[model samples]
Target: MSVNTSNELRLIWVYPDLLSTYGDQGNVIMLARRAQLRGIAAEVVPVRSDEPVPTGGDVYLLGGGEDRPQVLAARRLRADGGLARAAEAGAVLFGVCAGYQLLGEEFAGEEGQPVAGLGLLDIRSERGEQRAVGEVAAQLDPDIAGEMVEGGAPAVRSLTGFENHQGLTRRGPGVRPLARTLTGIGNGDGTDGAYHDHFIGTYLHGPVLARNPALADHLLTLVVGHSLPPVASWADRLHQERLNAVLAGKTRPVCKVQADAEPTGTRRHRHHAPGTCTTSPR
Candidate 1:
């Protein structure tokens, strides 16, 4: 399971055709930049239409989108069953926003709810008519708590990001939350995100990897498994120092919205639970 740092690490980004909303693409670029900085080569593959989905990738990234697009991606994945197979083969998976929603067993849509998802994780997405838009503080699970010395998970640190979505998620029975929120139930009560084995699904925003590099490293570690090189030790120390400063709000980078904004044609639709036909096209 060793990843050749000199060789390009294959990272597959699925459902890009529908979930390319926002700055999701930035996430992959951020990962690539970080990997290069560490002397590791990274390759990003975007999976859109029904082509053969890649397997055994070092990492899989999925982002958010509108409800219809979400459904279409779900259906496509379901038919191909690429995600499940990849999970079985131990590929690292990261799902964000609607991408996170579609990773669950089911997603409740506005019109016909309870749509089947990739089912890689035991979670469900419901209508969150109320948006969780603003800065937030979260608590990471204890297992990886000690690793948050620097640019790690936001745990207890204020995370600034915009959350503009209407669907919330609930981890299924036996599932665990990656963190407890300081504010909105971004997902369901008792749930904000999840990571089982190499799979990481979260309502966390795009550029999320930029904000949480430690988590990114964790996923890369999982994907590379025993193949990773010995930690430079100094690298960790330096990384932590820089990360802590950022989390401490001592190093804030200017944030700007991108220029690729375009209307998807779908207007805001009312919320509805599982079942019923209440959908209107965008």
Candidate 2:
């Protein structure tokens, strides 16, 4: 689980061909750029369905895809066993939307039939009648936020993104959510994402990392194996500008769902949940 001897950080972009819906490949680009800007040599390796997943990667990224592709990706991942093995060896993973759903125990397939997942996370996703799609903003779990940024200058509190999904995830016992929903329907359960061990799964798209540079750096820190000194760059400026625009009330096209149809535990405003990094019993 150490960086390659050549001093290059190996990042595996999992199944990009099958899971690049919503411009998720941008996440891999963002991760590499952030590492490069900080003087860390990084190499991105795209793992497609036809290839074996690389176990030497420091970080693995899986993006959203259509239901059929998701089911296929799930089956391929289960058979390859590379992601599971890499995670066992302490590699970090970031799964988004359909990718996020596939990390759990199971998710509804294209026909609403249950499909087996990689089971890297202790959660299950079911297809819901209402799809959650819109501009999403969530308050980061305080403890996770505290650990993400260097110098503790008020860790990035809010995560902004666009969500478009129909899977409603129910967290298993002891699972901690990544954030609390501030604007859109997240997980259809008030929570926005799931975080356990070194794995993070979310429905946020906006190619999430680009809009949340601190998060990108946080993941990079894991790969580089140390606290990285913060650098103010064009990426930071762009992130702030986008955030400011979001806060200023500029919004994107969002799917409409009846208010009464909202999930029971979700709230219209932010709610602080206790943050814990404990993983499911192995």
Candidate 3:
């Protein structure tokens, strides 16, 4: 993936029909709006599971999904071959929750069996006995800070979002932890996400990009190959609010062991897992 020399940015949102359990699609919107705000022409391409994924996107995004759907998505993505090719060619890719799990070598299936994944990141996920649900925040790894401009917005030290997952992820030598866990069960080992090369995977999903604009900008910078001019302060205030709340122990709950009944709207995604409430931090 060459540095975006042109003014337009091509972004691909993969498997929306199958992998959009959370409002994680907002991640795509966040990237696009942020780029467009900076005077870059941003084009978002949505690829359904049945459709062919284009391999020419500068960046790609994958969101959360359920057990069966995730299994199907992994299988179909392998057959599609476009995403793997794009990654192999150095496209920047970001995935959250089930999408993150599927980017690894394997993740637990609905029956507790291991299922093959897209193998984009050197990580693995296994189903834990208990579901993890709550607000989460983390201090971004210094490595992430190292990539930022010398005087850019103080280098985004911490990140905040919501998380709901049953899989405990372990990072392999090929990747590094995206951040150190500050609150909530991310990766179940005090690490929040995994990153290697241009691929990033995470469990946090208040549409994680929405809560952490610096990260969104990081991806944009990778594609654009330069430090972008700062846009606004509103996202910084929002980030600080969540970070301060989590640091002060405001662990807002997004799911319980059992929800009495599903809400009428999109919150229905919360009812997918059995025996306990599970969702994409919608």
TM-score of each: 0.73, 0.85, 0.86
Candidate 1 C-alpha lDDT tens digits along 26-112 = 678866766666678888889884776766567888988888888888888888877778777777788888888888888876584
Better of 2 and 3 by lDDT: 3
Cα lDDT listed for each candidate: 0.63, 0.79, 0.80
Instruction: Give the residue spans of candidate 2 off by over 4 A.
Output: 150-154, 252-282
Steric overlap count per candidate: 5, 0, 0
244: Cα error in model 3, Å: 0.6
RMSD of 2: 7.8
Question: 1-282, model 2: which lDDT tens digit per residue?
Answer: 543456788989999989999789889999998889878888999988989998889889999999999999999999999999999989999999999999999999999999999998887888887777667777776667877855322267778888888878887764578887655677876777888878899899747998888888878876666788777767667766766665554664222333333334333222223341112221
Predicted structure with the largest TM-score when compared to the true one: 3
Instruction: Please give the lDDT score for candidate 1.
Output: 0.63
Provide the lDDT at 52 for model 3.
92
Query: Per TM-score, what order, best first?
Result: 3, 2, 1
Give the runs in model 3 whose Cα sits over 4 Å from its true position: 3-6, 150-154, 252-282
What is the lDDT for 27 in model 1? 76
